[model samples]
Target: MKKRSSVLTLFLSVIMMLSLLSACAGNGNNAPDATNSGNKGSSNSGSELKKDTITALLPPVSANYQARFTDMEKEFNALYPHLTLKIEPASWEDMTQKLDTQVNAGSPPDIAWVGSTGISKYAALNVLIDLNAALSDEVKADYDEVAMKYFQLGNSQYGLPAYLAIHSIGGNKQFLEKAGIDWKNVQQNGWTYDQFRDAISKGVVKNDKGETTQYGFVFATSGVTSKDYLGIMAKSAGLPDYFDKNLKFSYTSKNFLGLLEAIRQMIDDGSMPKELSSIDAGKRWNMFLTGQTMITGKGLASFENSARLNNEKIKANDGSAVADSIEAEYIALPTPTFNGADYIPTAVVDGYIALRGKKDPSEEHIKNIGLAINFLSSGSIAANYSNELFLSPITESARNAAVLEQYPRNEENVKADQIMMSKAVPARTDIPTDLAAEALKIETEVIVPKLQALLANEISPQKMYDAVKAAAIKSFGEDGIVVD
Candidate 1:
């Protein structure tokens, strides 16, 4: 009986051992499957990979600007499947206002395409990220020194320079030929201020009844274009830097006064449109487009548009070619020289600025933003952007590509790029913060109104100078200005 009982106990123990082994095997299989599941769902041990979305604000450059960005977004997304971009378009004025509002509300876009003029202002406000530390040396080397300097404040780079715009007098070839001026020669050897004045005088047309039908030049004296035109004229008059080295307004300088006098003379001679001060920018552009103006300052984009419109056969309501289709061939002339020195007009560098968030962004987020900027500012992208917009490229590779791809098709683009690269000086960078603010105040409150008066023949150059100087002295302190 004892032998039988001992055998039964041994059998039960064997069954229990098997059950323990089976349970251990089950746990081992389940543990790895659970761990693999967790690993598959996460990038790191503690957290899942967070998806990121970046917002970009841009001012409209052309009708197809948004579409181009849309394509770019797709390309960017292909490489970074976890990242997304939302592009928002706005007008220049609206963009500025919206940015201001966004900053105040602590909800600015991650990136923005801002005007070069505003770079300094934004940098001063400490709203932009210092790209000097963020961008790689290889990427920085791709940009032009002048372009890089345009948006630099101290050691910090506030923006990535993108499109460049070199303005030159675009002339109607028919009117220029009638004036006994070869546009090609003028482009090769730039015109003197006197020669420019003479061309304008000769280019003007009148009816048999002495009714003026076409003017030599037309431009609005307000808005961003006016600032560009005025700055170009100031530079051409041998004052490449609008402010003296000491950061004082050079409004009272002889060269600046000469520029004003030349404009007054043009207005008096009917070579320039008289109602320029009152005309809207659209009207001014239309006047140039319709062949009512012979020569006017324009960027490559506008020049191309004018050239296309001039070449296009106008159709009537019935789709028949109108007999009076504007027979004009518009060509770019070298910027006119004043003191025997042709100072090529440096273009306004519109570019992207990465903004500092209200709270510090993650390392990955910062890296992604930098990558986006680098992609946008790449040689190929720069080439394509400038090519499509008819603007000058800011990168050397883009410039070379432009010379090859754009020159054969549109020589004007290449010419503009060459002028910007070789002849254009960097935009003013020495303006002190206090001096800039005062100068801006003087410009809007005092100078613009006085300039309008001078253009209207309501004020003399001396009176304009006196008023501008007095305002500057009052704002910047008497010692700030160089009294001649």
Candidate 2:
């Protein structure tokens, strides 16, 4: 009996070995080819996948902006060899117009970097892909909550935040020290509106003949610049939210009036130059760089980049004696608060949105677009892009990267970013998705002119409020204004 059992076991082992050999032989024919895997648009099975050409429209904000996009292309292509990325460079205005035209013509780009204000507008138009249904939960969780909030409409997400632009009062140290204002201390503990008013007033430079040579603060009082400033001032002063719980225009509070009055007072006191009302954004920034203004409200990225450029120029001329050379050292000052409120810098989280083009794309195309968006919005890419552009990262992992710790200016900017993220009021908080275009129209057509008038002292704060209220009513009707 023992000899018979041993023979049966040996026969079973032989059968198992033969089955394994047969399975291995079958897998050999079905295995993916290794030699052709490196070829573009070729899969491991040696078959060609459908090649997707993705056009990306980006606003050029930095000198090396094109190089940055090129690097992104390489990075993305390394992971997605079948996808071809084409970048189209355009100025901000041109990009906006072109995108609008493309969307209207049903030929939109696959991806676009748009402003915070445009996200809701695009989402409302149903031009943007709903990321909530596209991205995985883990991918969605990678972004900072506050940053993601800016790109959301109701329960749907229209885009992923790419970078955060934190607005602060940047001052030249030489100018601040000459005016007996310690900018370092100001950085540690932000000043109140009253203190800011007095400091800027004293910082105004005059010639020997008592003619004004330089103003204290310079800002462009046109387009979105003036609107952002007014919103920040009014909101930081504890005014009612621009839109109430009902998503209506609620800018008729005393805080709104106070904001306008403050701007008028600054203009009357010679703190803010009246000429700013007509100057464009570029000229306004140049005014600050050329020492025509001591302080200005701008994104920290711009100030940091400007300082770096100036330093590079100075280094290039080392040991060459040049008199009257400008010594430019700029530092970010905390946005001044009002009525003891926390310093809430005017913050905007600009990001990229994926769009479904005029032709209904295949599911494979939609999946590829989602993958591209995820790659662009990843923490590593965000860190690299923000570090290169001198902007703040929108993801927590990117914010805490070791690269940010290496530069003192970046560290300072990161601290400012934290403050802005912690205590920010979205530039357009409660404007409903349906009313986004109307809100922007009212802002440009009605609000900007009134703000300019208020700053120029051509109109009273009450009159400005009345005009804004009337416009709001005309646009949204009385039902749109939330009554407390």
Candidate 3:
């Protein structure tokens, strides 16, 4: 991870650059105009571009993802009538595996939107093309160089970043205020672990029978998985990730023990769901949206708009299944800092990458592929994707075109999200392949299940720590883990 100061400087410059670009564009209130595609610096003319069917693997960007993709295809086809797009939908969890399978079968998709972590993995496999060389300088120059730097391996640029994503918590302001807590203040000034625990515990409400009508907190293994959220909690609270800032394996530190203890304490106090271990991400989100939970873990900024849309549906009553709709206000909050540690939310840069595939695409095919990629990942199209997720647009043209069109945004939520972005360090992409692979193994095979057991109250924090340490030692050897 870069120094906090360096990260802040880069984010600030990105903001300044976006402001200048938007000011120059002069259409501040306009929605993204997908029809005006010719002006966005594509050197490929209609006559020069080759006609071919390009298949793409796309992850779900919203609940109405089918409609979103349909709209995208329409816009893209309108822009390039010669190119045909065959988009395949896949969940984020399954995309990497599906892509790998297709690539190994000697028939990979022409394009896939992948997370930052997958770039290095795929680049190592020699499956991706270098966007840095294929894309025009005008399009390339608009992106924040630091963000683009994450996708580069030596001289080969693996992909073009779509947006910078921050994963944090979302809260129901009504519940917090009912508990006499000022959530706006918490959004501006982050809370400590102890304060967060106290606030949530206080926020828990009971019915006349003393049953938990509203849970203070809830989490599931979707979006930000438990391992990532727990890891980020430890990191923001001054502990190291699986690897420390020095880039050495260091998950067994005492601070890690503290993180486990803090989580268990919340569970014991009845502030969080006791059956949290069994709940999936969909259930957790529904629980929060329907007012059964006061706060949700691993909340993405995009969910703020989801809550708004849900409320709108409830008002319209135009749907068949509007029984569970909620009208509550929501805001995103940074994962609480511990002691005096800096607020750093877990973050990643998502990208649109083109693959060479086994089809052995010709030079013109590759050029056409690059042109399609540039269109999907820049200007209005990229802005639309970013708007769906409420992420900061990485490309200047996207920034200029971005507007809050789909859903109403909470100003407080936007402000809090921006603050978290200023502090977030995109997960380090430079780990040695062998060590990185081992770390991933340890995470899935050991850390996640053990942490789940801890959340389920099946094991004490000490026992969970001990078990994880033993597994880490077995995988990484003593020299790799932090002895302290």
Candidate 4:
């Protein structure tokens, strides 16, 4: 869920093609059909709800936020003719700062998109409205309980989970078959680290000159720091969370050494390229999509959407698209586990939150804002957003309306995605702000630079762990880290 600028660019490019395809397909307005818009809140009757305007801040769900939000607004207006909804598109990177500025100036938007981690912070600021008091029980009941928990603090519900983002390993089907691995089995279940190494090593091809003709795997590097890269993989190794609420830092623990060894072994055997530390994600992704590599780490569901978009362009003979688009399917698999470790993909949940504006509003206005939030966050409208973004719907209504046929999707990949989501757990969202900031500083300033040396094979994993531990202790004090 930590999206890079390049990924956003890719998403925008895909959205352009999606618009063209959907236009040709004639799926009018981009909102679910009235017959299919299951569980949208009851329409306002007679003069029960008075006319009011509510403003919202949302990120671009598609290429054009205006177009998408306009369609949603139209759909919402049909049910609540009296309420006028105005949506402002904000980039994910700038949303928090922008929202803070507005809230400080006593003019926060009625509703906005916020990371689940930020809900508690905003709730503490007294800027958030308790959603439990706002949304109807019928609507709230439809949301997945796991996702809903992120919005709850004590008795107040601060937000509604917008979507589920899962990160997993992706494989090329032809390469898996050539390597004598059953793609279906890998996709359905998962592989152990040893199995992963053996399979990828088998897939490697070398020329007569001893140069690798094709790599077995590629690691995505751009937009990821060393802490994130290792922390996510550590879960598959049955390691505890590296940083916990109790301020215990476990990155130096002995168990973590196994994860480092797995990566080094992968590289030492030539299953992964030595240049992994040098290349950015763009290069690695191109390698995977063009079949230069058989597998990729840090894979996203969005890649499938990208592949579909590329294929659509090829089918349409669009000169703007990549010529050698992926023909064989790209499928996702759960991360390779270590020991008897359970496979759990890293997940981040983002949600919609209603804010208390500068001035106390009338109850009717608050009611209107609640209705607007529910309209955008639940039911078929929410499903449409999830479909476009390749996100898991958090509401039962959205889930029921999530028909893959609505867009370009590989059924196998979709199945694998669902499996990953079922087992996925959210990142720690309750970390205190100051401590979180301190942890981030250590990650970027201390851990990442040494990680580069580790990736380049210039330092042993033990040395890398030791160096980071020393630096962390110096900053956090010896008593802070979990030495075990």
Candidate 5:
């Protein structure tokens, strides 16, 4: 999936909450029970392997990356015969709808991927398999810690981190140099909302008549989180997730209102324009690529694509010409946070789960499942994935050691992605669905809007925040979706 500059898309990736944990540490809410009776029918533990078909589900496909995943399925089938795994593709566009349809139809895949955002709903509806009893500890350690927290109830495991998709800032370097902006300082100091606004405000260019020649910010909505960018900010701000003690949800909050007020402030300062509000990610991206904009927050793929398009050294495996050809030097940098919160790197983990059921839990079954995941998580898999499509590996070891040597991207012959991990607001796994969405809603609708109003000289950010908190509580209590 292409990472959008908007914040809601970040949560959309987490909609499944795979490879996740609660933002709150060791709340004792998601650890599995010792008895762990979820994996039933463990009769087949012999050396002779048995054959069972397992289905895996993955997130939406990008047109650029579709062929890459197809090659993965082919390789998996070629290597493993005793355990046949089928992959079903679902785009982020209608993920929750399709997932709900599958559950209603009683045709759940044995092991599948989902969004952290919707994990609470699935857990509430009892639609997943508990893998705590099945997986060994050694295998568990390879997972992203936040992803581990994403797949539990009171306590138990549901999924592993297949691949992670994270976010950062992307911009046209030519424009940056023209604007006299220093990306190095921005990266080192970790730009806050105020700093982000100041950068954009000075960078936005206008003609003598005050006619705008360039915009500083743009939006990338994808199919999820159409207009909300607060989801992206909340994770970075060290803000608590929306779930309450009972895990109920609401749509307004003081923190979120404060954030919105901040963004609106940017608008008032002539940093981010209101004209870019519509849900046209492609247009916004194209604008940025063409140097019509100076900055926008997005994921690695866009930065890679942007960089690859500009570098004469970059080319496809087939010796074919690349699209969107241009000479732009840009890198994906850590997105800004409010105040001084640390960076919280998050991604949509394409996870799989084996449900507790009538089927025999034979040794072959466990072995097969383990092997499938191993292959998927292996360096070879990353190689195939990177070659076929521009994908980053899930493991630090693979990303750091093998990938750069195996297949380098861009001119620097830069090896695989070294996703600089930080201890930001840790992921929240135990939280319920309604609570998460509702809480996110408050950030976008209630908080950000007020911030925008403040920027427009409508109200003070502090006042907007104070007033919105009471309203947020009311919405969550009366209108927000409540789960758990």
Candidate 6:
């Protein structure tokens, strides 16, 4: 997490703004415990019988985030008493640097929770096992196109989301009344680019001293998911993709360059903090919490978290119920659409979860992954995990009107999920599984740098796109790299 300025420390002011964004585990193949083999073990027909322990890796805890999985772990162990499931928590940084290491050593944990930052990298690397054979018919049937398609890679299903959420407009009715803005007017008029841009302009005000004391909308680094904040706009505009169909790097796409420029333009226009394009995500959110920033990209839980932090004064007219804990007030926004042939970037409701290997995968490992995945998706377990984790259900039953009414906090989330569901285009799942990460490195380490140069006015979007395309083709080939 990044540090924030003093303003984010406030409780009441937080309620004045916030419209923002958005856990889980299962065991994999290995034996319940791997370390204790020799003393009570015997070799079978001169073939060494090896045992492995099942574990899940995640980043360090941060306000209710890690708790989602830790809660699931407790329940999972209790339900399946014979399994010895262990959680290996560390900084996401550690997982980023160490995942390949453990996997290369042939001792990676059986199951793991991953986020956008690392999923593409690992999926390309093929460190995670193929999940196609393991998915139960019932489980496969339960998923909507978004979850089923998003985590796929080439021919394999490497991961699956627990749910789907969207990032969109958020507003506080009280703030609107005070500012003489019409809340009903905006929603009824529909969220157009012009309307959204104007709302922010109308909302911002500077005091006599030249300090902005109140802002109409807030979009900080914290206001959106760090993983694909820019990707959303690109999706809206119908660009190709930043990544290849295999979840690997294809950063040279016209789609990606176009999206990056939009984000850069937003920063340039002052709708977002100039520094926001540079700040880390946690720091950005902390700013929202303290009222340093108000309007944010609202996904599944941002509003909920904001509601928890705001005071009654802040909650005045926001539709969602975060008034008490959230220091700010907010309402769900219709996800803005792109003008071109694209859709909004599809975000997995579940960041990502996949089966890793203790060694090479086997029938036993496949069974464990299947059973764990099926049980995890079962409706009986869905309510606990979904509710506690603040997730949308992939199953239609969970999305049924009755269940949604029972969980009103989930209504905004569900609606956002619908937006993602309706507009999201499918991710191509055709890259060779093993090459996933080399592809990602091409995007992050290679393409992003070139893009920064291009966005700084040093080059054209076409030039940047072409350069990236050339490199990708040099590295991955035509079928492997699609630049649109």
**Candidate 5: Cα lDDT at 340:** 59
**Model 2, range 1-484, lDDT digits (tens) per residue?**
9999999999999999999987876564533221211112224322234567778788874455656788778766765667777778888657888888888888898888887767766776778876565566656676777778878776777777887776666887789889999876777667888999999998799899987777888766665366666765655665535566667676655556666777788888988887667766666666766677788765465566666566666678864322333556777777677755666666767878888776776656665666676666655666666776677666765665555223446465556556555666654445677687777777778878888787767889889988987888888898886444
What is the per-residue lDDT of model 6 for residues 273-352, given as tens digits with 9 covering 90 to 100?
65454445555454455555445554444455445445543556564433222455555555444444434544544434
Runs in model 3 deviating more than 4 A are 1-51, 63-65, 68-82, 92-97, 124-126, 222-228, 317-322, 356-365, 402-407
The sequence of per-residue lDDT tens digits that candidate 1 reaches over residues 198-234 is 8888988999999788998766665555565566677
- How close is each model in CA RMSD to the real structure? 9.4, 8.0, 14.5, 15.5, 16.2, 18.2
Which candidate achieves the best TM-score against the true structure?
3
Candidate 4 clash pair list: none
Ranking by TM-score: 3, 2, 1, 4, 5, 6
Give lDDT: candidate 5, residue 114: 63
Off by over 4 Å in 2: 1-48, 223-226, 239-241, 318-325, 339-342, 396-417, 425-431, 482-484
lDDT of 5 by residue, 1-484 (tens): 3545556777767865653543443353322221211111223221223456766666633433344567666665555434466777777666557666777777765665565555555655565556665565655655556656655555766655555555556667677767777765555555777677777777788999997777776555433544335556665655445553455442243445556566566666676666544435566666665566777755554366545544643344333323443456665556678645566544544544544333445544555555555455544544444433355555443454343223345532122133334333445655644555455556556665654455446776567756665655576544443321
What is the alpha-carbon lDDT for the whole of candidate 1? 0.68
Roughly what TM-score does model 3 have, to 2 decimal places? 0.82
Model 4 lDDT, full chain set: 0.72
- At residue 5, candidate 1 shows an lDDT of 98
Using Cα atoms with residue i matched to residue i, what is each candidate's TM-score against the true structure?
Answer: 0.80, 0.81, 0.82, 0.74, 0.69, 0.68
Off by over 4 Å in 4: 1-53, 62-66, 90-110, 117-129, 153-155, 206-213, 224-228, 240-247, 264-269, 273-284, 355-368, 389-392, 400-415, 425-480
In order, candidate lDDTs are 0.68, 0.69, 0.74, 0.72, 0.54, 0.52
Q: Which ten residues in a row have the lowest lDDT in candidate 4?
A: 28-37
- Could you give me the TM-score of model 2 versus the true structure? 0.81
lDDT of 6 at 425: 55
Rank the candidate models, highest lDDT first. 3, 4, 2, 1, 5, 6
Residue 221 displacement (Å), model 2: 2.7
Model 4 misses residue 164 by how many Å? 2.4
